[model samples]
Target chain A: MGARERIWTAALIVIGDEILSGRTQDRNIAQIASWLNVQGIRLREVRVVADDSDAIGEAVNALRARNDYLFTTGGIGPTHDDITVDAIAMALGVGVEVHPAARAMLAGYYETRGGLTEARLRMARVPAGADLIENRMSGAPGIRLGNIFIMAGVPHITAGMLEALTGTLEGGAPLLSAQIGCWVAESEIADLLSEAERSHDGCQIGSYPFFREGRVGANFVVRSTSQAGLDACMADLKAALEKAGWPTIAGGI
Target chain B: MGARERIWTAALIVIGDEILSGRTQDRNIAQIASWLNVQGIRLREVRVVADDSDAIGEAVNALRARNDYLFTTGGIGPTHDDITVDAIAMALGVGVEVHPAARAMLAGYYETRGGLTEARLRMARVPAGADLIENRMSGAPGIRLGNIFIMAGVPHITAGMLEALTGTLEGGAPLLSAQIGCWVAESEIADLLSEAERSHDGCQIGSYPFFREGRVGANFVVRSTSQAGLDACMADLKAALEKAGWPTIAGGI
Candidate 1:
């Protein structure tokens, strides 16, 4: 491991009562985790909190302090429950103000549809000394204050904001993974998987077991910062499973 | 509120590398949250951690300290990647040991399918002083240590564990909710929603906005411990929206 290969980590906070209440199933964590992987950043931890301002503020402060970057989704809409901005601003010890450029963008977006009302104008509020992440999906721009990035709760809108932020953050080597599936139970080959991972430097293997078609099986995912290491580890794992009398499948069954 | 009506809160920690690697989408969070609500317990927070032992131990300790109850899902299987039991035992400062009852259950389960191998026997391990929660879906029983409940990662297995634990824990009155949907944008009625919620005691309102049928609308959810308060708030919210010329729908669109 060199200085240039330092691993970058991020944490995400999902803010919403709907998610906590089980009224909504969150898709942001997986989506953001995958996107961060492409950017060579590992999503280390995630906290799902209610729409309460204190809970949001505490999660923001704690996660932002530990990770290289902190991303939050939800509670940024034009509804009464959308209070992420207020909470993040309180966490940063800054006053919330309507950003001029954001207000202009919202004005133009609603000019053709319907005039921006007082409630819709709430979308332009941001913490002082913060920049905007362009949201082409909706005129209400995402907020960026220091290490924190705030985006929409909607999956498509968040995708648009992420697209606008592609390659903007500094990151390390992207993690590479190779998957091998076998019909044998994972416990039967637990020692083999551990041994393979231990022998291969800079590589880790994760085993996911599943019961399908009345048969138990597992998919072993080999991950490494280096493609060469990943390939070697996968090869060794597959060979070991084969030697143990379990035929390996290239892609998971 | 009476002494017996004290609210109970729980935190959940999802332990898995597959979820962090974006290879798996988590279903346990919503499932657990909804189940906790049915048990008259509010899910206060949720953290997703990796399969690493240190990460699991740290999250278990942190969440269990602040919440009345803490639940964990995943990494309790027989594979090397499944180290949740080890981590949780470490967190509780207890040694891991094979429970006699769990071993007997596994023995009976695998006797018909295939004789319990060394790998399957690993499922019998638990913290030094813990009891087993019966799992009708699988032979590997869920672990209960102090305030922490450890469950299987598989959705059905986790559901079975939750079912077994239902009505076992003391809890407050279950929260009730009433929903009213209107075609008008939420921002237009934000003040009305806030005023209605403020006027009502022991009630909180959450508005979820969506775009459907080429129109913007929102569903307002009113929650309260008292059914009468929830109904009254819902009536007020609907009347206010209707007075503003937006008809209300009983259920969300």
Candidate 2:
């Protein structure tokens, strides 16, 4: 194997009581993970915590200390329970202050519909020394402080913020993947999958088994930072599966 | 308010590379969270980690030490990456052993479909002193060791295991909740929601905003351990919204 490249890692904290109560299915984890991958930053961990200040603060401190970058979603709304900014500010031992740029943006957005009330202005608050992340979808903007990025709870708004952040952060090579699907039980060819992964340096294969159409099947996803490595591993896995009498379908089922 | 009851809490560890890689969207969180609420146990926190053993072991040790009950989903299959049992056993300072009951169950299950091979036998392994939580939908039984419940990563399989173990864990009163939807922006009623929650000692109000059908709207969810507390909070919140000229929908829009 060649010299290993620096791998950029990120962690996510999904802050909300709605999620913990099962009132809202979280959409940010998958979206953020995918976006991080595109930026060549691997999302290493995710934590879903309630809207409580202590819980949010604890998660923020722990995750931000460990990863290269940390992203948080939820609780940045115009409501009393939207305590992410305060919790994060407390966690960082910094005071919360309204960013002038964010305030101006909200003022302009809400000018026609309604004037910026105190509750709406609450969205402009951020940790001291933090900058604003543009949110094209709504009046409120996301926040960024050091390695931490605070995003919206709503999925579409979060997507807009992500679009704005594209290619801005430092990252390593993007991880590449190829999938092969077969109508065979994972246990049947477990050895082959293991052997293929072991032989391919810097490559990892994930087997996801499913019961579909009255038959057992599995999708093998081969991933690596090196496109050559990923392609080689996928070819080997596909050949092995086909040779074992389990016909494979490229790009998965 | 009456004397406060002991609140039972649980934390969940989601173990998988697929989830961390964004290859799979997690459905287990909502399902498990809803099921725990129905059983009167609150899901306090959740952590999603990679398939690495050290990551799993660390999350297991940290979360299990604090919560009354700790649950984990994923990494229980019969593949090279299926290392949850080993990781958890190491975390608990226990050795892993193949349970005869689980082995027998697997043998019976695969008797006609290939007869449990070495790879499939991997599913029978568990911590030294763990009991099996029956899987009505598959052969691999979930593990229960002390307060830790280790189940499958597959949503449907996890659902079946949850069904088998329903009403088995000790918990406090099931939390009650009611939702009221308003076409007005959440900022307009932020004070009302906060005031209603403060007036009702045991109640919590969560505001979720959305943009639908070219209008701004929000759903306010009131939750409390006591049904009376929940009903009173909901009534006050709805009345306050109506008095403010924003009509409320009973079950949310």
- Candidate with maximal TM-score: 2
All candidates: DockQ: 0.73, 0.85
lDDT score for residue B53 of model 2:
88
Candidate 1 Cα misplacement greater than 4 A, ranges: none
Candidate 1 chain B, run of 10 with poorest lDDT: B112-121
Best model per DockQ? 2
**Could you tell me which residue pairs clash in candidate 1?**
none
lDDT of 1 by residue, B127-180 (tens): 999999999987799999989999999998899999999999977888777788
lDDT per residue, candidate 2, A11-119, as tens digits?
Answer: 9999998888888999999999999999999999999999999999999889998999999999999888999999999988999999999999999998997799999
Poorest stretch of ten by lDDT in candidate 2 chain A: A1-10
Looking at model 2, residue B159 earns an lDDT score of 94
Task: Compose the digit string of candidate 1's lDDT tens values, residues A1-253.
Answer: 7776799999999888788888788888899998999999999999999989999999998899889999999988777778999999998899999999999999998898678888889999999998999999767899999999999997888999999999999899988888989998787788899999998999989888888898888899998989999989999998999999999999777
Residues B1-253 of candidate 2: C-alpha lDDT, one tens digit per residue:
4325989999999999999999999999999999999999999999999999899999998999899999999999998989999999998889999999999999999999999999999999999989999998888999999999999999999999999999899998898888889998998878888888899998988999999999999988989998988888888888889998999999998
lDDT of each: 0.89, 0.93
